[model samples]
Target: MVFNRKHIENLILVTVLTTFSGQIYLSPTGGTFRLSMAVAVLTVALIHFRKLPVMLVCGTVAVTIPLFRSVVDYFSVLDADFGDIFRSYLPVVSFYISYGFLFLLLSIREKLSHPLSFILSLWLCDSFSNILEFSLRQLISPANIVSDVLIQIILMGLARSVLTYFLYNTTLYYIERYDRSYQENRYREMIMFISSLKSELFFLQKSIVDIENTMKDSYDLYRHLESGPQKEQVLSIAKNIHEIKKDYYRVASGLEKVLSAEEDRSSLSSREIFDLIRENYQKLSTNRQLHIHFEFHCRTPFVTAEYYPLISVLNNLIINAVEAIQQYGRIVVEGRLEGSIYRFSVTDNGQGIRPEDLELLFIPGYSTKYDTVTGRMSTGIGLCHAQEIVENHFGGNIHAESDPELGRTTFCVMIPFDRLQEVFIP
Candidate 1:
């Protein structure tokens, strides 16, 4: 047998449990018939707890249970002689020692996964151990060991074995479910954190593309205005834009490095992503104290490598829904994989857009919200940016539908499945 600190600690635990539970027994005062919970406990502990070294623990428990009980018995009845007290309990030692060797011959660990085989092994161990103890008792003082006693022992052993088997499997069933639930929650948290990080990264990257276009257009204007009266002014504007572009480029590059330094955690399950999006939006708007209900209509899981842009697009739509609502509303985010296309819809019960404005929602600098206090229109670029990413990066299209009477709006995005998976750098 092998041993380690952990293995020894387990041995000690098994011994302590066996000794204490062994004390709770149904034994007739002068008869050898005995039934103890300790037998069931020892079988369960040894079988279920794979870390314990079986032979060593069984040997230790065989000695500990009998010795510990005898010492406790001697002290409890101070008037009784320790020798007779120990001798009367002597047959139990043979029972445990024989049971351990018998269990070793059975290769108990391998049978655990097979419930029927496991129960049979336990029954054999318990029945044989009791017979050994009764035989030892007969040796000390002659008594008839009848067939009736044999039948009773076997029946009791079978009862305990069946019960242990049921209890172990039932406990395993619950534990498995708990672990899956814990893992699902953990995945949601991790995706939320990554979504926050990569969403910012996406903004910086998108800005780089805009800065490049601005720089090129400015340089072209400078060349066209050369030798003209406004030559110096246009040249100055081009140089200034170049400097700003350089700064933005450096920042975007640094963020790219920060993301690339870690392992590739690019892809995530769509079910958790959808659930997290719903939960995160709900929590962020809680301070509004509105009777808003957030709902997710998709639980089917798919894998996506374009989570960064995907989340950024959904964030804009959800934020738009929040801003649209005043006091009470419901927001539902739904996703479906249809044929070769992945479709997502964000629907909300808010102040709906007019039919004319629906076509203009994706246009840059177009928004329906007007700030009365400041006498200014909102920045209005959020939907435009989402459309840009969906159309350009994902090869997808986004559109809006509004039912003015019902006061509801739904923004749907549909992308080819292959396009989303192609976005992962690694």
Candidate 2:
């Protein structure tokens, strides 16, 4: 709209393109008067880029087309000079210049919303401009006019007007479709992003609950040792726990505020949840194991409001499977609804859990992972946290089965449909 350097460059492009369209013309009865797709090209250009000066484009085309054709014509005849026979194409110059101004005077661009009015106005401009060309040609050559030629000219204008309208509509249709696809993909990404944030909020709330319980136990200890030598130490421990509880409360409050806007999002689909999970761990897998591949399946459509704990539980199991594998492995996650319960299983072809340690898998501070480089023990609470969320939040059960002979471990979780999906069932 500013008529900057970009607009000047675009104007030059429209000028060259319109002149090229005019060059591809056909003479009806072996005369200099020509019919071409120049009008259609011009109309489309004006419709698409409203900031391009319409008059400047059309007037420039009028000069460039004849000048280019005259030079070509002059070269065709070796005896002709620069000025010879260029006047014969003068009618075309009048034709396009008149077409440009008549287009503006008729308000063709503004009436486009009314299809019939726009086409009628367009037909008027093209037909009248051609008629002016024919009259000028008659004055220059003293030729006779036929009635059939006039009708053909008018119908050609109508045909080109209708064609231009379709061209514009088809272009608009594709643009709308592309915009719709882009918006749907962005919406999916947003839902997954909110799901991750909600998972973190669930952990913060659980930490606050644990801190509160610990503070109560510490105070009870101080009361029991009221007259003992360690009585003040017990009270000091209670006070320190009290301060930690307040910090946890501040963190929980901040996380709650961040999730406030997304609270209205009632549920999420099972397949979408798994897709997000697959995308997350697959990236982590590629960094450690080049040949690690993942596959996920959902037998029935499921939607649940308990997706925060759900994501946390699945992320723990999959990460455990990923870390258990040394270099190359396959991890498959499958979910299904059976009767009144939903079940999910994560199977991995990794180093299997030991037979004697199977019963100890859910115990807090119990793990088999040891980091040789750092000489440190794994925090060993991942499976315990996962179990707590499953059993406490969703009233579910989780367990593992090992086929040590074949080196595989599968952890399965079962939750009631009524508990996980009462708010949104799908």
lDDT string for model 2 (297-404, tens) is 988677877776788788889989988888889999999889888898999999999889999998978989877689788877778878877887789899999988
Give one digit per residue, the lDDT tens place, for model 1 in 1-426.
Answer: 567787777777888888888877776334433677787778777876787766676777777877777798778886978788777777887777777787778877688778789889888988898888877777787656456667777887898889877766777788899999898777666666665566666666778778788878877887887596587777788788889878988887886787666425757667656767877777778876667888887633577777767887888889899888888999998887677787889999999999888888988799888766797997887798788778877899999999988999999999887876543221
Residue-level lDDT for 181 in candidate 1: 88
lDDT of each: 0.78, 0.82
TM-scores vs. true structure, each candidate: 0.59, 0.64
Global fold similarity of model 1 (TM-score):
0.59
Q: What TM-score would you give candidate 2 relative to the actual structure?
A: 0.64
Judge candidate 1 at residue 244 and give its lDDT: 86
Which 10 successive residues of model 2 have the least lDDT summed? Answer: 191-200
| Error in Å for residue 241 of model 1 | 11
